[model samples]
Target chain A: MSTLGLIFRELRHHKANAALVVLALAGTVALLVAVRILATAAERETRRVTRDLGFNLRILPRDVDPDQFLADGHSDKTLPADAVTRLAAAAGTFVSFNHLTPSLERRIQLGGRDAILDGLGPSVVGPGEKKQPMGFNIPSGKAYIGHALAQRLDARPGATIDVKGKALAVERVLVESGTDDDIRLYTSLADAQSILGLPGRISEIRAIDCLCMTGEQDALAQLRNALERSLPEARVLQIRAIADARARQRQTAEKYTAFAVPLVLIVGAAWVGILAALNVRERRPEIGLWRALGNGSVRIASLVLGRAVILGVAGAAMGYFVGTQLALQAGPRIFPVTAAGIVADPSLAWWALLIAPGFAAVASFLPAMLAVAHDPAETLRAD
Target chain B: MVSCDHLVRTFAARAGTVAALDDVSFRVERGEFVAIHGASGSGKSTLLLTLGGMLRPTSGAVSIDGRDLYSLSAGARTRFRASTIGFVFQLFHLVPYLDVRQNILAGVPRPDADARARVDRLIEELGLGPRAESLPSTLSAGERQRVALARALAKQPPLILADEPTGNLDPVNAGVVFRRLADYQRAGGTVLVVTHGNDAAPYATRTLRLDHGRLAARLTTEVL
Candidate 1:
């Protein structure tokens, strides 16, 4: 009979032992798979929640007065519009910053009332970054008028409005945010520069900081250092509340996975090793008999290790299915914002198939060696 | 044919070193059924294992068919043992998971149709046909021993080493085991049986008495 046939028969005879090993392997794989999928969903949820908190890093012209800029929430001085491009093109700039939006914000008279005119340029992103742009992308002649400003001007969607002798189409009315945004008129950067009589100039660049570090790590210092090297003419200001919240959320999720994965792996390996040892112990007499029957060490070792690999494969398949189902069922309730993005990752299944068997084999290696090293004379001569 | 030259196998005990086979020498010609009888701890099993190439003696040498058993590499020795010798243990060490037929087939190294046919014949001769597919656990002590005997005889090796082959059987079962070994010997195979009792005396061509790892006496079957 083939060695595999023997192994199968042995596994069938020792169903409880085999089932326990498969269970341990399956549980470990399930925990790892669930952790991986859930961790990804947690990251997505963090990004969405933090992105909704708005851009935390402000890149203002270096020469702007700090007090006046802080009070006015807009820089009096301006940088050339291409400064955003220059900063984005800088090496490793996106390592600390993303979603770079150049804007010219200033208080203007609209329909005989004071309103903030916020002109947003096309967002400059990191090279090869697939993240969706954060803010609106308005056309040259279109505007997204604030709720109060739309009421004041009696403007509706697709209505034509006049701004400094230029005609602009009202694209949409913004929802009331109960902030200065309610009285803000948003337009394309080129239109703002034209109306403000400062063509090709932007007052500031808004961005979200990517340095997910705690306050104790001095995140602002790192952001400043990065900005100084990338855009020497601009200085960065961080909104502490938003930056800290995003940092804590991201770090918490990372810390959870970092602690969980290794713990599960260690416990799983120990469990497998112990069970393999027990199996070797139980089969001592049979192993001796095989040795006396002229079976070589390779054949003896294959019996033990082969069973582990088979169980590992079964565990991988079962765990992948169960874990994917768990994530699909529980992900929406946990991270409702990115629930639609939580789908089964086929690559994870392939990875499980590749890794689990090797892991089980490594764990069972010592026991297999013990079986090979057993002395046939010891048991055979016992009579 | 098997021969050993002044073989000495020692075990390290807490009291001191003790020889299991103390400079003992013997020879067995082909087609002979030899029985070595000794009391418990008289080194009967040790001598049998040493000759089987399963145990390496502390000193001296063993040759099977003129090839130095210990001088060969471990792999070569295993292959030599597989092709030249078959072993039956007192405890009937059958693989618990395999049925009687598979356990019997396990003895046939490089099993083929001829080996399978021989195994079937041995199974029938040993009266294990009804229990062919039954695992060793389901078999009685007598039946398990018969299966072990069938397994040993399956490969039809020139040498059969029976270590207390009937130690766990009743008188009737023990007679059946000796009869099978004697039949194999009559068919031109060599047999070596080590037992604490003289249960194998009737079938043995000659009997060697062992006392405290020494050859105390040698007697021809006519003396019995």
Candidate 2:
């Protein structure tokens, strides 16, 4: 028999004890992997929600009510087209700017039903304006509708539909925002104005205030100062609640991720360490017998350490598989992602697989030492 | 050939240090089956352990084939024990996890074809052919001791050291163990065994008796 075969024989002799060690190790690795994935998923979900909120700060006329903007649809405080244009110029590389001029009441008839048809002008984004989920870069004679509206009208991209006596091609369908975005249809500024017979008029100019994960603290202050200096007619609306909530959301996500990973590692190491020590204790006599049978201290140590290697690696591999399944099923359910939005973050997974066995090995170090420390003369002499 | 020159082994207790082998000495030639007889606690096991390099002597030295055993490093001494000396215990130190064949094979670090043949022959000679694949737990006292003896001879070492080899066996099984040791002596190998009584006296070419860890003078038994 081979040297490795000797270790296997010992395992078979103490099958229940070996299984206990393996199970404890597997649980440790599985929990560690799950915690890491949850942390990553939390951060990713925060970013996705922040992007879906469209714009953080909106530049509306001074008369616009802070609390009633959603109900008024920015139509209660109208701004001229040139005023919107110069405000974009004044912002100058500091923001992503878009102008909106709704259809009078901002609700129109489409496919024989009343729907929100907002006249959205093209957005002016800086060279480094990371993402523009709601930029609304509309062109003439084409339109984008929300997922609910498309479903109601059975409309798809590239199909033409009659809108107020004019044929417009369906450009794209937006994902469900779970808000009024579901009932809204955004048409080009020129098309909406001509159709409403109110050319060169806009309800409001919207500005996404920051370039970072959030735009609440210094970015919001800078925007207030910029607008006060240049476009005094428009006061930067803080959008009240979203401004504060976004910053708090991001901070909580990052902190949770940081705190959870280390905690998982500590728990996993503890489980493996205790169980490995017990496993060594259970095999003390076997170790002594091997020593008495003309095997040296080094060979005895190899037998113990070899068992640790197998348990560590085997437990880690099994944990990776089980943990991935758990993460996949739980991630989308937690984030409410309808599609397969599980970003596995392969780098993190690779680290888990690499570190799990390392936990097992390091945990077994003291136990392996204890195994070789037995007095063969006394131990073998015992019944 | 083996020689022990004034070997002294001491153990310390809370009260004082006591010598297990008090200035003891002996010499044995090749192919000599010598039995060292003593009562319990006569330090017969200590003498065998010191000679086998399993225990270190506090003073003096043991040399096998002109090489000083105590002069070598700890690692070298272990290797010397594994490659040159074979050991059998009163309790029959057979690995319970392994079958008789594997227990025999366990003595050889890496058993090649010749080593494997040596183990097979020892198993057959010990009358353990049918029980080669059986675990030691299932074997009788005689069979277990025979397996232990086979394991000791697995490497075909130049010397065999058996401490109370038949101490745990019945009279019939004790006779079985002595006959095997006698046969090994006839094959031109040195054998040194420790026993509490005359169970192995008929098989030994000479007997060295010990009392209170000291060799008794005029203690020799010549078998014609």
Leading candidate by lDDT: 1
Estimate, for each residue in A240-338, the C-alpha lDDT of model 1 and write its tens digit. Answer: 899889999999999999999999999999999899999999999999899888988999999999988988998888888888888899889999999
Worst 10 residues of 1 chain A by lDDT: A374-383
Worst 10 residues of 2 chain B by lDDT: B215-224
lDDT of 2 by residue, A1-383 (tens): 76689879888987876787677667776666766676667666776676466566767777777677767565566667676557656644355333222222267776667688777776655545554435667889998988888998898999887777767799999999898778888788788777776788766676555534344446566667777777788777666566566667877877776787677667766776777778777666666667656677778777777777777777777777677777877877887742255655567456656776677778777887887777665544311
* lDDT of model 1 at position B177: 93
Off by over 4 Å in 1: A62-68, A85-96, A109-115, A126-130, A137-185, A211-241, B12-19
TM-score of chain A of 1: 0.90
Q: How good is the docking of model 2, by CAPRI class?
A: acceptable
Clashing pairs in 2: none
**CA lDDT of A15 in candidate 1?**
92
Q: Give residue B18's lDDT in candidate 2 (0 to 100).
A: 73
RMSD of each candidate relative to the true structure: 3.4, 7.8
